[model samples]
Target: MFKLLLFCFLIGITVGIGLLTTFLYANTSIVNQVFLRDKYSKLQCIWLLVFLTGCSLLLYYTFSSQALYYSLIFMNPSLEPLQFWDALWVVGITDFVVKFYFMGLKCLILLVPSVMMSHKCKGFWYMCLEEISQYYCTLVSTPVWFRYLIDYGAQTSRAEWHFGILLALLYLIIKLFFVFGQWKTSADVLRLFFTQPSYGMAATKRQCSEAEDICAICQAEFTKPIVLVCQHIFCEECICLWFNREKTCPLCRTVISSHNHKYKDGATSLQLRLF
Candidate 1:
């Protein structure tokens, strides 16, 4: 009966979180705009507060639950059922809290530094972190027998933690190598956009006429327009903004350049599935 109740509670929590996440994702654009704007309605502010509170609670509960479960498994390899109070005692007195604290600290270490970095490098670093975390989750989600093997090995020696630290260090080194390459590419794209005459050339009267004297991006008359290789014309500012997030012409979808653009606004999703 206890197990059944616990399972039902987990299911209910999962369903509720999932529904909330779906709603937020569906209105992601509106949420973003509301948060970014200097002035927003009172309701929007309330909703934003609710969103942040939900995220904080979710993170807290997830890490706490994971730590409790892992500590239980480490203590009782056979996974014996326990009374609710017994489980709570194990969670409080064991290494669970320490592990949970470190997990949260590690996330902050990864996120705070990236947030402080320049816009050009922030997205790349975030992407690298996301990849590393996805790989970690894949390892964590391996078969139960594999996890047991890991646990057994960990119990035998302290080398497992050292090995994990070394592995993470090596991965960071490799990712840093790629980061430099990406930074160079982004710099070159910026230089080309600003320095190249072809990219910023003024649209002639004939070109403007051919484009119906309008910039398709802003849905208004052309202003300091530029023509692309695909013959699509747009306001230089408008196109520059578009190119920051995309690599193709907005209208024809033709490849604008071989170089990739940095993420727009240095913004990235904070959902790191470390479990």
Candidate 2:
């Protein structure tokens, strides 16, 4: 009865946490919009604090569970049965807490400066957070092949550790190559945005007459209108702002250019497929 009750309690906590996270994520756009428009708000500050606290709690839980699982698997054979509280105290405090501290430190390094900088840097911190979240999720939900490799390594003798380490290093090297490729692609896109007028050509009178006179982005009369490949016309300044956050034609969703980086929303995807 006690075990069943404990399980039920855990499930309830998990569901509640999931719901809270979803709600916070749903409101992120509103928070960003408010921050950009108004500069600051007391309620938005509280919401951000709550969201960050929730993230920290989730990180703690993940690290604690991982530490406990590994500790159980690798407990000294000669050591008597591990006491739950003792193991939790020793492993959780030493290993999990240290790991969580470093993770939090990384986040602060990425975020603190952006917050302290000009209001124009609003999207920068959000993009950094998204990248960090993507990396965290990828680490926690490793590929099946990598899991199998880790399991084999865990079960092997000390002599096999070197071989496993070598394999892990090789895997990291290959992954780094892909990451480099992505970085290169991003650099090209950045160059295109700066050095070239890839947004579009100036809209001719004929083009302007055919398309809407008002820029879709700013919802105002077009100034220095540029017609994109999709035949949609927008103000150069308005389209530039839109392209900063999106690479698609606002009307038709056509990709802006071949140099456009692979993006979902404004955040660049760091996800890689092992298969």
Candidate 3:
């Protein structure tokens, strides 16, 4: 009866966490879609991730032996303590590692190009890793205590408590550092967008064709127009906002750069003075 109740409780917790993860994943997908407008198929990826994560957790607490057998095929850990919590412990650890480690690896792959992954990918990975770690820690702490309660009818040992606390603290520290870095990088990128003048601004003095004066981005008159290296022009603010989500110009699909591209802001100061 005790084992059954414990199992039910664990299942409930797993289901609840799964639901929360799904909710968060959906919210993130929606936000990205609104802001990015189909630049990438991130929603599909998130859906896959959420599905895999929930499946991992479900397999861990329930029918984890098959997964463990395949996952640890070469390791050959002894399973003699099956009647005890050994199987559960192995399942929990394996599940946590398989799911979270791969997710972390994906995030690392995303980061290889730039730390500015602080954009959207960073937060997604952080939330995912945090969830995985939370589940792992709970699994690590709960089973031993529950086993003690069931077997000896006593509380867990002081050593177990200390170990659990230390593990939790360590995980907390790592999560905090990661979250801080992500937020800091995101803030820096945002600051860059706000501080720098747009490449389009250099073209404000140019004569507008009946169509050229209108900004494609905002569908308004270019108030402080900037020109891309590709010679496409837009309102400075509009282009800057667009560039935050995508590096390419809205019209020509030319990749805009923060530096070194020639801009045609109508005329130079020398030309103005000469005129």
TM-score to native of every candidate shown: 0.41, 0.44, 0.36
Candidate 2 structure lDDT = 0.48
> For candidate 3, what is the lDDT?
0.47
- Spell out the clash pairs found in candidate 1: none
Candidate 2 on 138-186: residue-level lDDT in tens? 3332332233333344555865756666775676677667566566545
How large is the C-alpha RMSD of every model relative to the true structure? 10.7, 9.0, 16.9
Q: Could you tell me which 10 consecutive residues in candidate 2 have the lowest summed lDDT?
A: 71-80
Please report, as a residue range, the 10-residue window in candidate 3 with the lowest summed lDDT: 266-275
Candidate 1 TM-score, true structure as reference: 0.41
Ranking by lDDT: 2, 1, 3
Error of 1 at 86 (Å): 17
Q: How far off is residue 247 in model 1, in Å?
A: 3.7
